[model samples]
Each structure stands twice: as C-alpha cells, then as structure tokens.
Target chain A: MIALDYSQFLTFEPQHHWRIGIAIYLFLGGLGASMGFIAALYKHIFKKDDPSMFAWSTLLGVLLVNFGGIFLILDMFVWESFLHGHITEIFKVLLAFFGAAVFNGNFHPWIQWGANFIALFSLFGTLWALSQADKAAILNKLGFLVKIANLLKPLQSVWGWGTIIFGLAVAAYTGFLLSVAPAIPAWSHPLLPVLFVISALSTATAWYMLWTYFAKGKDEETQKVREHVGHQVEWADIALIGLEILAIGAYFNYLYYAYAGGKYVFHQMLSDMGFVIGFLLVGLLIPWILEFIAAKKHIRILVPLAAILVLFGGFLLRYYILHYGIYTYPWPS
Target chain B: MQEQQNKQLPNWVFVIDLNTCVGCNACMAACAQENQTPYWNEKWRTKVEQAEVGKGDNIGRIFFPRLCMHCQNTPCYYACPTGATYKTPEGVVMVNQDLCIGCEACVTACPYDARYRYDYEDVEHNKQLFGEEFSIHQLPHIDKCTFCYHRITKGLEPACVSTCPTDCRMWGDLNDPNDPVAEIVRSGRAKPLAVHLGTDPKVFYVGLDTLPAPAKEEAE
Candidate 1:
C-alpha cells in the first residue's frame, strides 16, 4: 500500500537555528558560572583570607559571561531599532529577557530564565571581584577601584553567596534551556542538566589550574600557594572528569536504548563519526585516562595536556549535542 | 482558560483531503500573493509536499499540503521567550512580530518545521525581486502560516481554501455541531498527523492511506 510516510530517516534538513555561535556562548557561560561557584566553595572549605584565587575566578567569570553576551547580541536581529537610531535596542532585549522571566507567573521560555541567571551571576561576580581586588592587591594600582572595593568590603560575603547561587543557576540553566525543548531529541533530556553541570565544574577547574601554572606571582609564599592550588585543582578535575564520563555514558544509554525519541537522537549522533571520535575518544576518554595517570603517578607535567583536553572535550560535548540536535518529525496517520 | 474562551469563539479546524489534491500549486501561489510570504526565496507559509509511490507502471505521487498545525497544545507558544508566539481565542496561533527578538527558539521548537526567519535581509531580497509593490514587514521576525487569519475572521474561507480548484481543503468551526469539516473530523474520516506527539493539531488529513488505517476500531 502506498503511504505518505513522515519517516524520521528522511530528515533532509537539520535544525540550523542554533549553531557554533550558540555552542561557544553555552560553553563560556557554563565555564564562567562554574569557576565563580567553585572558587566560593574553595574559600569556604579551605578557610582562607588569601584573595588571589577568589579574585581571579570571579574576575574571569564576569569577563567570560560578558563576552558570551556579545555572541547573543550578534545572533539577535534587532536591526529595526538600530536602523531607527535607537541605541537602547539592547536594553529592550535585556529588559524583555529579564523582565519576562522575573514577572511571569509560570516562569516559562527557558531563554529568559537563562538570561536572568546569567545577568545575576555576572553582576554579583563583578562585585565579588571588585571586593577582592583591594585584598588581593591585584588592582591596587587603580586607586579608585581599590577604594570602591574597600567601601563595599562589608558586603563581601553577600557578593560571594550571590555568586555561588546565581553562578550555579547560570550553569544549570544552560542545560535546562535545552532540556525543555522537546522538539530537539538530542537536547530534550533530564540528563542534560546533570551533564552540563559536570562539564562546567571540570572545565572551570581545569581553567583555574592552567591559570596557576602560567600566572607569575611576585612573592615566594604566593607562588607556593598557587602551586598548592594547582595540585588541589588537578585532584578535583580527576573526580570531575570521572563524573562527566559517567554522565555522558548514561546520556548515551538513555537515548540509544530508550524509545523512538531517544533512538532518533542517537541515530543522528551515531551517524556523525565526530561524536565518537572527536567527542568521546579524543575529547573525553583520552583526557580521562591521561588525567587519571597523571594524578596517580604525581606527574605534574601531564596535567596541562589533560586539562587542555578536558576543556576541549567539554566544548566538543556541547558542540555534538547541539549541532546534531535534529528535530523530531511528525508521523503520518 | 483558553479552552474556556474558545467556547464562545470559533475553534477553527482544517480538514485537508489529500486524495483530491492535484498538486496544481495554485494554493501555494494564492498563499504567497495573499500573505506576501517569501515565496521568491522558497520560504512558503503553505506548500505541497510530494512523495512518490508504487513501482514502474503504477507510479503515483502523494501531494501533502503542509502548514502550521496550530496545535491546541502549542510547542511554539510554550517555547516563545517573550510570548511573541501566542494563540488567539479563535484557536489561531499567531506571532506578534513586534515582541519578537528573532531568537529562533520557536523555530527550533516546532515539530513541523513550519516557522522560518523573515528577517530584514529577506525583506531586502523581496524588494529586489518584487520592487515597491509590496509593503515590507515592519520588523524582522520569525514567520509562519497563520491559516489566512485576516480572511477567516471576516466570515470568509482561507485564501488557499477558496482558491483550491479541486476543493481539497475544507475549513470549518469545530464549535458548531453542523459544521461539515468538523463532522468529517468527528466521523474518523480524517485525522491529524503526529497524533502521538500530543500536539493536538487542529489540521486534519484525509485519504493519505491507500490500505486504510485499522478503522480506528481495532482496539474496541
């Protein structure tokens, strides 16, 4: 019998709404948020007043998030306002993104929620960075910045706590944004948020470790402290990378073995050789093994390569999930 | 609450007969002209999809006219960040281009792939092709099939429906008991695509299956 079948295999066009641009934003945003949160946790756990690590993490978070925001602006087509000589176009976009998410009773449309979280994370992260500037003596040459940092020093804890809350929200929200999109089979999963959080933590940890390895501190004691930090973060990345591997494996099994929706997503993933070779093997498993060996043998030389691979793997993971995010086609009756 | 409001207004539905669709492309032309859609760029508000069937001597084609499902449970509506994609009381899913930020979330969320970007560039291309004969869209935003909303509300059939030479497309109000198109839907003579998706689409298809489905009574 002749049938007008709406076959899933006949997907002629993949979803191009989100591309590499979005992948970069999600990556940077997740990285920034995780760095900010992890730094706060480190301070609380270590009970240290030394501000270099805290200041650096928060400062990097503010910068990365703002940089990611530029990609969003590039993606938006608000040329109507621009053509009309309205520079407040971005303000309108921001207000709409933030206001709707904040005021809406149902709290719908995950993008707005994501934007709100990112904004809060950036704001508190900046303030936290400023507060630490005076103590860290990194921004001591900028007298007014130091003065402002000192004046706001009383609210330092508030900024730190806000950074943790909002930063974590931003990280998790990036995954949540894709989770709610049911049409895209690859992204619409409960496991996505878990996977993203793990990636965020690991990538951020690897980044800070790299910072310690590279950044030159003047004092002998500061150099020792940074070395200690680099060692500590290497340990954290080992655990975090392990978590990421498990999360990704679970994600694979969930989609590759579940119902048609799950199968549909993995079908696309499996077809793309890059998903396994680029993302799984080179991006994830290789790095995981390297980091494991490095930590076990106390091979400090191997940490940087593993760290860089982890960061690359994190981006590749998101890249595959998004780029291969084929939409579920309708079935003909 | 939307369903409650739909009680007073028309719950518009389309019952499209695939068997009768000759693939004339009249509906496409009419739709493009009526809506000023980006037809030049092959971005259609409504277009017939073709699939070949049978081997050799008995070769035939299925002409499936595709458009926005205007689902009762709209994924596009749920996905809109600024509520730019909204459903009218009369069951028409519409996009408020003014509120649209061109984020393309709704485009990705649509299972039907019905939505497309009708940006300033597309408008500029329209000018190059059609000149100033068309009044440009005020703001660049996502565009999709609106079911000829302007005509339907004024006690007129949708442009495509009215222009269909084969009478393949039928429009009616589901709220009215005597509505013929609604009766076609009620009788199980027609059914919507992707029933499993739970989109609850208002548009229904007829005569696409040559073998006929399990008569909607196999379970019973």
Candidate 2:
C-alpha cells in the first residue's frame, strides 16, 4: 500500500481551519495545566485551612487537556492496525488513568502524585515536539542526531539557565514554540513566551478562585481560606492584564514592520484570522477591561466570566500563531 | 587571506538555469541511476518539478530541479537520532549508510518535505545492482540527493549535470568569487529556496521566474 503523505493529513489544509484546530489543542492543553498549577500553588502558599482544592481542580484541567489528544486519531492517514514502536510510544497509556482521577475528584494522595507526574510528562512531550524543529536546514538524514547536537551544544547552557524558569512559567513554553518560527509576525516576539507564562499563571489562579468560591458545607476555617484565596486570584488577574497588553503591543509592532516592508502580511493578519475580532476584542480585551473594573469594585461575580474570556482568548492567540506561522503568502512578482 | 582560506575548503553549490531545462526528468533519472536509487519508490534524491505562477495564457512554467540545499546550519541534521545525517568536508549534506538507523527524524525536520526513507526491498535492489552486500529486513537509511558526492570526490561532475541533454545545471564552489556560480549569485540572478528561513542554502536557482509554493501545506 502507498504511504499517504502524513504531512497533508497533519495540517488538513486551506490554512485557516488548521490554525483554529491547533489553537484549540494548545488552549486545552495549556488551560488545563495552568488551572491545575495555580490551584495547587495558591493552597500551598496561603496555607489555607481547607483541604486543598488545588489537587482536584489541577487534575481536572490536566486530564481534560490530555483528552484533547484523542483528536490526533482523526489525522492519522494510515489508520493502520500496526502497533506504534517505542519512538512514537512516548505518549504513555497511563496518562488516561491520571486524567480520569482529575475528573473523579479523588482526594487520595497516590492519585494526586500520579496526576502531577503525568501532567509534567505531558508538558515535556509538548516541548519535545517543538524542539524537534529547531534546526536551520533540514535536508538529508546523515549523522543527523550528531549534527543536531552540534547546533544545540552552544545553546545547552542557555537552556539550562532557563529550565526552572520555564517550569515555573508553565505554558509559557507554548509561546517559545511560536517565537522560534520567525515566519509568523504575530508570534515572533522575544516576550511571547513571557506573556504565555503569565497567562498560564492567570489560568491557574482563576481555576483556584472558582473552586474556592464554590466550596461550601465546610468548616469556618475552610470558608475563610476560600475567601482569602479568592482575593489572591483577583490580584493575579491584574498582573495578567499588564502582560496581555505588552504581548499585544509587541505583536502589533512586528505587524507594522512586516506591513511597512510591503510583505502583504497585514492582509493575511486581518482577513484570515478570526482572533482579532473573536478572540482579541471579545474574548481578551473586553474581559480584561471588565475584570479590571470588577477588581476595583471587589465584585467577585464578574471575575469568573472574565477568566473564562481570558482563557478563551489565550487559546485563540495560540491558534492564530501556530496556524498563521505555517501559512504562506502567494509568491512575489 | 580569507578568500584564500575559502578556496581551500569545498563550498558546495548547485546552480540551475531555468531557461534551458525542458522538464524532461533527465537530471532526476541520472541522479537515481548514479546513486543506485530505487525508482517508483519515494527515494528520488533529486526530483524535477514543473512550477509556474500567475494566471491565464500569460503563465510561464519553469522546470524546478530540487535536492537538499546543504544549508550551512541544517535543521534536519539535528532531528536525527542515529547520527545518520551530516555534511561532508566536501560540503554536501550527506547520509552514512552504515550508521543510519532510519529513525525518520530528518524527515520531519525538513520544511521542504525533501527527505524520504525507502523500505528494505528497495534498498536491497539498489545495493545488489552495485554488487554490494545488502539486506532486506532492516533498511539501510534515509536517502536524498548527495550532489553525487561519490563522483565529485573522484573529480567528476555530478551524474545529473553530465547527463543533462540541456546544459541547464551548474555545480561548483559557490564560496569563490572567481567561480561562475558565485558570479551568478553576486549578479543577483540566483535565488535560494525559502530565504526567509535563514538556512543559507548552497543550491541556488538561476532564471527562476516564480517561487514554487509548497503543494503540501505541512512545513515538513
């Protein structure tokens, strides 16, 4: 049987739709993990009297994101019954069980530990995929691994310096993935990864706030913990707003340069991308504004909605970057 | 002094004049034969593409002869696991048949979709005809255009260049100012594939009228 060009199946073309799908995938992955991290961290930091909601919510978010990988089957061209070798076997089957634990809301220690391990592994898997494309020229498979290492050898120290920073920042890694692809004007900023890290934190904080606010039938100490944690989340939202502004401004600056050079980049950005209107304005900008207002007024109700919008917008941002970076303009005259 | 040092090192380059190429698949045929590559398999180290842009009767089509660009900083090299891919001292981006574990890392690393790994039967057929020891179960390695490194090492022009019924293909040291290939590039008539990617490709197209857009959407 002829091997189907797997590349075609992966992208599922016409450009725009591919972008949206990738955005959704990244969004699910990032949002889930971020939500989990913030919930756990806040409970740990604040030393809340309540049993940690961090463990449960974090698990929920992570499992939901890993569940998104089910869509990968829709793309496999061969659809052959052939067993995957160890190279492709990096995506372990155990991830499913860990994901299940999150949704089940188990407070068991073993479950939380297993879920955390899987979440961390899945994050590395995503990073490994991105690192797969770091080379400058991609011809011939000669001493390929060695050649790749030669290229990366110099960057090893740099990678080492930033590993913990990257870990703490969480989904900020997704931003670095886009930044490496210089082709996309919107995603090619030095600050893109930094912005992603902040968003990850924001998503984490928001999940914690929601979990805490909803917590009831608890002791007085637990109730006090819930309200205190909610206040901390409110502050995080403020920081997210600042980061979002910087990311947007830098991206637009890149667009200006790309447009001014008569690269026809602006046309693609406006016409092709639904993010500017759908994600940026409605999802991110408006929600951010409302959250700012709500923060000042100490209005907790609007904060969740704002968090929902911010998270939605973040996914859209990732979608456009991944998709648009891959899309090419028709060649010059 | 730098120019003299540059002359001592082999700066690999392929220059294709779009005007003379007839899209006859002569270079493709020659490359496969010389490399002992399997036909009807996805193992063409060099392939000919008929590329055109613009609309209507005014459209101009050019024969695009493509191989690995042998970039100064190659992306595919790093993606490999068994260390099968690397550049030779002769500056050709090449594969070591002995070392290649055929992991398909370079295949994904390539944005151009140039690399293809053939199965054991195909590899055996190619190796058998050359009177070399070969196997069927485990295929040798990923195959691509070596710029005919074997012939070039023996001080011969590539089979593709020599077999071209039309003298459209040019191969030489691109680093040298005195070389015709360098002169052509300095004259601004030659263009590299995906210059925006910053691969600094050695293969340059002369008389290219249009950019060949990737028919397949995926980058690799």
User: Of the candidates shown, which would achieve the greatest DockQ relative to the real structure?
Assistant: 1
In the predicted model 1, the residue pairs found to clash are: none
Candidate 1, residues A177-210, lDDT tens digits: the string is 7775666667888799999999998899988778
Q: Which tens-of-lDDT digit does each residue in A139-209 have in candidate 2?
A: 11336544554565455434322322323543654554344333334545566667676666666666665
Candidate 2 — which residues are off by over 4 angstroms? A1-25, A36-51, A57-166, A182-191, A238-242, A259-265, A289-303, A327-333, B1-10, B28-64, B78-85, B94-145, B148-159, B173-197, B207-220
What is the lDDT of every predicted structure here? 0.79, 0.56
lDDT of 1: 0.79
Give RMSD to native, each candidate: 4.2, 14.4
Give TM-scores of chain A for all candidates: 0.89, 0.62
lDDT of 1 by residue, B119-165 (tens): 77677766676676654465567999899888888999989999999
TM-score for all models, in order of appearance = 0.90, 0.62
Best by TM-score: 1
